[model samples]
Target: MHLNNDHLISLAETFKLLGDPTRLAILVACLEQEKTVGQIVSDTGASQSLVSHHLRLLRGARLIQPRRDGRHIYYHAHDQHIRCTLQDMIEHIQEEER
Candidate 1:
């Protein structure tokens, strides 16, 4: 896929968002199950406000999506693409460790 300047810039932005450890933890926490802000905080050991902030940024990037139920919002990866991409990247790193 040929990425133009605009596309490259957007891709860079997405990587920047994913570069933060806290944000990565938040995403990993919600990978297998949709999690509320409280659950994310517990899983990531980040403050609730911090988790919310990262959640907003991730939602904006479309890397994570939200579903509302009553007064609670559940966050999770929108589809298999992110999961598969992460799994592939993990394997790549593991192979490098050999």
Candidate 2:
């Protein structure tokens, strides 16, 4: 596909975001289901403070999205594009191992 300069820049920024292990873990935790901050912490063993911080960056990057149910907020993989991209990348690596 043809990507303009802005598109390329944004793509690079997205890669930079995914380069973080913590943030990547958080995203993996939300891949299949929506999770609250506490659930994410439980899944990844990251502190609430740390999870919250990463969530902000992930949200800003549009890699994940937040939903509110009353006082609690749930986060999930942003959309099919992100979800599929992540899943596909994982598969790519797994394929190499085989």
Candidate 3:
């Protein structure tokens, strides 16, 4: 598969987004189920503002989807590809710890 310049740039940008620990944690938090910003903040032990910031970035990247229910917004992995990629990375890291 030959990636043209645009595709290559997009791929690089995706990785750059994923390279942030807070953003990665936010994505992982959404792996199993949708979560509210408050839930993510509690789970990740990150500040509410920080989590919200990363959530915006992830949503913009299309790596996550947000649904509004009343005043609350719930976020989840946008597709199985994202879930599988994160799961694979988690498993690989666990293996490395052994």
Candidate 4:
């Protein structure tokens, strides 16, 4: 499919979202289990505020979704598309390195 400039820019932002190691790690962590902000902090060893910041960026890019449970917000991949895209990207990168 052909993407217009705007769509291409959006796609770039999505890939840029994954460009950060912290965000990538967060995505990987969520792949195993849906997690609350606190859980993400504990698992990633990042400060809660820093994790929240990355979460906001991921949510803005539509890579992840947050569900509210009372006062807590649980974040998870919105769909498998992001996961599949990431897997494919990784395989491509590995192939290039070889």
Quick one: best lDDT, which candidate?
2
**lDDT (10s digit) by residue, model 1, range 36-85:** 99999999999989999999999999889899999999999868998788
- lDDT of each model, Cα atoms only? 0.90, 0.97, 0.94, 0.85
Worst 10 residues of 1 by lDDT: 82-91
What is the RMSD of candidate 4? 2.4
Instruction: Tell me model 4's lDDT, rounded to 2 decimals.
Output: 0.85
Candidate 3 residue-wise lDDT, 1-98, digit = tens: 99999999998999999999999999999999999999999999999999989998998989999999999999999999999998998999999889
RMSD (Å) of each candidate, 1 decimal: 1.4, 0.9, 0.9, 2.4
TM-score for all models, in order of appearance: 0.90, 0.95, 0.94, 0.83
| TM-score, predicted candidate 4 vs. hidden true structure | 0.83
After superposition, candidate 2 runs with Cα above 4 Å error: none
Question: In model 3, how large is the Cα lDDT of residue 59?
Answer: 89
Ten contiguous residues with the weakest lDDT in model 3? 52-61
TM-score of 1: 0.90
On a 0 to 100 scale, what is the lDDT of residue 26 in model 3?
92
Candidate 4 Cα errors over 4 Å, as ranges: 90-98
Off by over 4 Å in 1: 96-98
lDDT of 4 at 48: 87
